[model samples]
Target: MRLRVEFTTEPFDLDEAPAHALAAREVIETAELDAVDVGPFGNTAEGSTDGVLEAVDTLLRKSLEAGATRISLQVSVIGDGNGEGGR
Candidate 1:
C-alpha cells in the first residue's frame, strides 16, 4: 500500500523555516520515502504504508520536542487499483 502524509507545524514563519519543520523533514528524508516536499504551508511525503507511518510517528514526536505548539496532519491511501484511494 502507498501512503501520503502531509503536515504543518506551528507557529508558522515566512522568513525562516520553523524548527519543527526542519525536524520533520530530517525524519522524512532519513526514511528514504519515494517523494518528499516542503512548502510554505507544510510538508508532504509518500512511501509504503509502513515506511510512511513510521516516519509520521517519528516526525510528530520530534516536532513536538522541537517546540511546535500545534500540528495539523492529513493522511491518505493512494490508489491501488481496488477502489481504495484518497482516504
Candidate 2:
C-alpha cells in the first residue's frame, strides 16, 4: 500500500515556526520516503504504508517532545483513479 501523510504541530508563531514543527519536518525528511511536501499550514510525506505510518508515529512523538501543544494529521491511500482517504 502507498500512502500520503500530512501533519501539523502547533503552539507556534505564524511568523516563525517553532522547534516542534522543525522536528516533525526533520523526521519526515529523514524517513527516506518517495515524496514530501512542507507547507505553511502543514507537512506531507508519501511512501509505503508501513513506512509512512512509522514516520508519522515518530513525527508525533518527536514533535511533542520538542514542545508541540497540538497536532493535526491526515492520511491518504494513493490509487490509480478512485479516491480513498483517512485522517
lDDT of 1 at 52: 87
Top candidate (lDDT): 1
After aligning candidate 2 to the native by TM-score, how far in Å is the CA of 17 from where it should be? 1.9
List ranges where model 1 is wrong by over 4 Å: 81-87
Query: In model 2, what are the clashing residue pairs, if there are any?
Result: none
Q: What are the RMSD figures for all models against the true structure?
A: 2.2, 3.4
lDDT of 1 by residue, 1-87 (tens): 788998989998889998887897789889958778878887888888888899889988999999899989998989553666765
